[model samples]
Target: MVFRIRPIIGDSFKRKERIGNRRARFSSLLALSKFDFEEEHEMNKQLDVHTDTESGLSGELNAAISRRRLLAAIGMSGAGMAAGALMSGGIGLAAPRGSVTEMVYGLSADCGSCVVPATIAELRVMTGTVTGTAFYVTDSGQEGHFYYDPGDTSSPDDTGLVLVSTAGYRFKRIYEGPVHVKWFGAKGDGSSDDTAAIQAAINGLAGGGVAFLPSSTYIVSSTVSIPYPNVKIMGSGSSTVIKAAAASNYETMISASGLSGIEIADLVVDANKANRTGLTVRTVAILLASCTDSSVDNCIVQNTIGGGGIPGVGIALGGVSVRCKVTGCILKDCGVAGKAADGVYTSGTQNLIMNCIALNCTDTGFVIEKSSLSGIIGCTAKQCGAGAAITNASAADVTGNFIDGLTIYDWSASNTGGIQIGTPNASLGALLNTRVSNVTMERVAGSGPSVYARQQGGKIIGLTLENIRINGAGTQGILFNATDILIANCHIYNTTNAGIQSQGACERVVIEGCYIYGGSFGIALTTGCTGCHIVGNVMIGITGQTNYGVYCFGTGTNINCIMNTIENVTVRKIGYDAGTLPNVFSSVNAGISTNATATATALGTLSRKFQIFDKDGGSIGFIPVYSTIT
Candidate 1:
């Protein structure tokens, strides 16, 4: 039982309101004053209140009050409505039945005088049967797509309902989706120039609407920008391809600027990098400039150039974007050398870059710099000049990041970078509390290490590297210069110098449960290092030039070595030379002694035990650091 406040009269009620040039008569309002209480009571008595059909609202309405009382109350309410309408301008027009109508086929060009004569692809405009006063275009896709002359200044109540002066206007399915490009006369064939049609389809949508592309190849010569917020452009997986036309000089295929909730996904973008030119111009397949809460997912963007904004990116969330993502995309052959190009570049806060593959990029494969609380997960960068590069470029120190599940391979021999966090001479803020785990970096023909964390100005505090595998490097397998670091459960091999090396001053370094092999030095700490705990690590099989297994040059104090295994080294296992050494030193593993002649092994403060202080805070014996007796 659909409950509606309709007058109980044989003649329907009507209510009329002027909508721009057209009008709507609600019909039910005009019959309100003619409703009779006795007539309504008679009609309600025959409703069969005991027979519960669907809603069972009859039982509720019938039992709540007597039919005579209910009908009398409705009659009084109807009289009040009539009095109110008379007070407000008065209902003067003759109520026509229904001014709205739907039609299957389109209308002819000369159907009405004031209706637009343009061709109607689907729904046709109809002339008003009653003296050409009312106008309506019924059929449209997505329930609310509209067509109007751009010169019409007055805004209508509904976007779909634009009633002009007459009813002869032809209906055009302006692009709106769930807005499909096909509805806006975009021929997705390879030869056609679908730039204007696709652009109009995007512009037709209101905010927070989606524009969909079916499985077809759409060729375009210019850029298509999404200027509205909360708009999405989607495609039918890989079969929906957007390819650049021959000699297309557009800087970008698709772009959006400072819009939120914007997404570009499920499409194949072929930038035609071979035919594309302009070495000085930056090129991209999809660029989301300074847009927040956006993403580009499940896309294949290839043959793109980088030269536009320092580092050309296949899909970029540029200029301090926040909470954006680029996932499941394959970016290849982007950026020429010295142009600062990259795949999936984002300079934002709290963004996510995951499961993307960047191959053969001329510069960095993936770069997420100047970001806070952002991460790159399960991404691979292969055969690029640089791979998986990131740094904190801001002045204020920030923290909380995870670089996990990243695999980088075959960094260029000329470039000294692979999975790098911070440069040695960078004038930036500290990247603190960062974790790099489950990562694999390999360089078969290169001079640089697999992983490098070198910060010059601001310190990298509280860094953790675990479950990592680094193979074949030039100097060290991992160049670690961060403070308060932990390198645990890692396998590093085949380096010219040490497996894990720290050049400059570092503090509180811990190397735990790691396998270090085929390098000259297993763990090398040089100059101004302090508070190192080398524990439970297996260092064996020194390759190339035979050197000490674990070397420490100038550890100021407190360098503890416990349960560390070393073998196959002619030099001393644990070597510490030079620097100040006046405190208690302990016997370490078998390696090179301090210097050539091996005087007393001096390890500034190799305190294997802790001191137990008395309650009086004086004269307490030390609690031995290492529990080897057990």
Candidate 2:
């Protein structure tokens, strides 16, 4: 049954073919030389056909048939109405190999006196532009895709929504899915302003969809905002980046403002601060403002403009934002020089910043201020002004904020050091229950990263600083001005000042189960401090300092020092200021204690109250309650 394939509609369009075990293969006909290959092949194959539709062309066609004659007659004479019906619009054209196929791009060849592709934006779509609808049009007279939002008030040129010189097509009435930013003309060349082109893709998402950023570098001059809810824009990891333009004052590179369910992931944002000379206003790399239940994950953000604080501080949840998430991000070199800016800052309630790292920031590495019930966990900060800060000024008490598994190291003496919980305004009400635990600090400087809690202008109702370890070189140690506080299981070593100091008006503060080493005074009770109990501690003092194990100064009282071991201390184990009140002590011992006016044998000259015994069941000596001279 030798079947004949009627001569291909035209002859000039070369159609290459190979025949094997009942299979007909045709080479791409440069797109325009289109054909219904499946139907034509099936029909021909059913009849045991061979490659006989070979011909040569010399004449031209018209827009009446896709101009270049892509609409050339698919002559299937008697091949059945199925083939005929397919040739008409009843059957859709098969999609090509690639989603995007560029053809006859720039150079203009004439089609009968009219410059080919005088304007692609003005090309009449097979289906004219309609509201909130997607239509297929010719890509500069080839093939193209575009959707219309007649209500979109943004400038069309900026959006690239109405494209100019390009070529591609889409299957008519196909299911709409995530659109690529490049489809809207994003060059991603790392230089061209592709912000509008990319934003156009996001805006034209029909109704709440995703915009994919391919593995390319897109330069944005301003923030790419997600104004509506449930909009997601993602990229191909580090290979895909959105960079800030030179000298452009961008509040945020990518922003989700007043919208929820937005996701920003797997991308890099370069703020380009080296060239941002005129950037006066604050800068943020990415910000979710007043947005809830959104997320920013696995993003690498470098050189974020702090705008002195968060509008980003790299990535931020600002503007009453709540229940959002920022996780697995690396922030580097954020904040402005000679000014304060944080790596990650949030004043939003119930948000989370987890497993994130901040490096070389000018201010706090991560800040939770005036926000309630938020948490920062498993984070690290290096070379920052401070590791983390939790403060409340006036905007609602900073209550129930928690920081766990934080590591801060490598700070300078000139910087404000360590983790701080303070009230900057000093007038706010009780900042209730802020806890910092499982913290490790190494090579700390600038007041020695002591987990300082300076409760001023108001009161810290409940502060818990536990399971802290600070070591290897610092200027000072932990300072507390908080009330109803618990400082337990802390190991602090090698500070220039006292290991632990209580200042301001502190009450019911318990410092126990701690190892304090290498400081002038192991514990100092200072002005407005009272009701402090220091128990079960090992305090060691370095050489060349007064080295009192416990020293009270200024105005404080009701201090209890019990079950403590002091070693290598020069001054008395428990001493007080010349005019301060006497402190109570019990079961306290010292390895090497030097009292200014007393010695151990002085007990022989004073009245004896008790006796000490050796391990061999022998009476060692008589002990006295008061022995002053040594």
Candidate 3:
């Protein structure tokens, strides 16, 4: 009778017990009192028990005598009541009779030999490789299939089991199944058509499915062709509306070309535009052309109908659309009057327009054309005609935007700024490496320029405007004509003109930590400004009809606005309300108004550590002026 079952540590049955020295510990009551079984079934039918040799009784004493005759035919007196009847009645495979009957047949004393699945359909046919601390499935009919890890005792025999199924889980297969655009006959009842039944249920989605748009109003009459690839067009949030019957033959009421893993969430794209009166062309409610990795979350692109005179874009990520995303969307009243409506339009490249909201647009309420490394975070543009328009973009990142009331349309005398960038005609290009941070423009009434940077035909290199906050600017509240520009920590107020104006042909300009009030020149650099660095600025209440808290001009014959550096500037109550007598520094020409000691030979390398005050705290000392004017 062969019997070899050694590895036992705790729960010692004391079979003459001598383990550590390797050997002796096998006596499940002397191997079930010497099990015989028809003389070992006639000596195992004349030996050769499939040749792993040593037969006759060495299948570990015939697996402890067939688990003591199946625990004495189920009366269960041993092997821990036959492993509590195979773990509360899911009794099936049984062979363990040692190591405390292999921990009652669920085998997992810290993964010594791993095989623990009492049920959940035997943990889904028990495969392997499961780690610790995260395994759930309490069998409400195998709820979302078994998952394992209870502090995984590592030994899934080297990475094997993968059985993970989600998204309407069924496990082992049926991975992503749920297409329902009313099961392909889509009649969300706002009129019927349902655009070929929601484009044939998004072309019968098979790759990572989910077309579902169930809560009503989907009368789409025309364009609805989401090409393909990993589609997901879920809705029901804003009651799933997708109106827009035929607003002029449809330039786009929902179109996704080229293709990439697309997604259009919680829908509502009305684009009714009062029924496109006469009709012409240019229209859009949601158009992603030449798409790539798309997404349009919490969607709602409103009334876009600018036909004939064209111009309506209410969400357009143009051809060249790459890395797209338009979050928490809501673009209103798209375009009407002379039609140039833009409420979220991107020429596309590394796109992302976060927390979106663009209202009353006719032109520019977020339009980053000719994109490159794009971004417009925490967005909101109101009463638009221009509230974020970055043309010929490059490395753009307009942050924390909140522009207001910028609709000064007289058919374009140019700069309708609440934030408008380049292209007066350098052949239309160049907004290079831009960044306008923490932007906030308020009450900006007509004439425009609450931030306008122009460099006719390319050259706004490495521009930056930080922590900006402007209130009531009708003209020039920060208008620069680029070249390595940087205006830091700005807070301009009540500007009628020049609260910050660095004219064209500018170079290496840097206006630091500003806070100007009632502008008519609280900082102006003209005649082709050169290497300027006006530091630590703070000019208060200069109501003296605007003269200067810092104004540098040159061209009294070729100094070409020399190297300027005005330091530690602090000009207070300058002419205090038209009483006239406040000039901290003004060097003009051709209508002459000179003082910097008569323009100090055209002022180059003029470094003034300035301080001019009034309103009863009189102090004016500005004599540190260096010269290098050529």
Per-model lDDT: 0.65, 0.65, 0.58
**What are the per-residue Cα lDDT tens digits for candidate 2 across 1-630?**
122333345443333321111001111112223343334322123222112322211111101122112222221221211111122222233222211111112122211101111124443222322222222433321223333323333333422234322222212211123555765678888889998888887886545656778788999998888877887787778888998999798677888778888888888988877788788777778889888899999898887654543333788888788898889988888766565567777877899889999898777788887788998999999987777888887745668998988998876533345888878665765678989899998874454545678766667879998999988546557887888999999998887788888767789889999999888888888876778888888898888777898888876777777778887899877888766664454453422232323335443446446877777879988756653444
If scored against the real structure, what TM-score would every candidate get?
Answer: 0.68, 0.71, 0.31
Q: Write one digit per residue (lDDT tens) for candidate 3, span 481-519.
A: 888888888888888777898775687787887887766
Q: What's each prediction's clash count?
A: 27, 14, 9
- Candidates ranked, most accurate by TM-score first: 2, 1, 3
Model 1 misplacement above 4 A:
1-176, 338-340, 413-416, 423-426, 543-545, 554-556, 580-630
TM-score of 3: 0.31
Q: Across residues 1-630, which tens digit of lDDT does each residue of candidate 1 receive?
A: 112333353433222432222111112222333334333311123233322322211211112223233223223223112121211233331222321132122222211112221223333333423222212232232222223333444533222323332344422222212456765557788889878777876886654566677778998888998989988888878888898887777678999988899988888887776676644467778888888999999998877775655656677777778899999999888866655457887777898889999998877788777777888899998988767766776787767777888888888734446777764355668888888899888886667777788787678999898999988887777887888999999999877778988868889999899999878889888787788888888888654468776787764566766667877876877777766341223334433223223334443444487666556888578654432221
When 1 and 2 are scored with TM-score, the better candidate is: 2
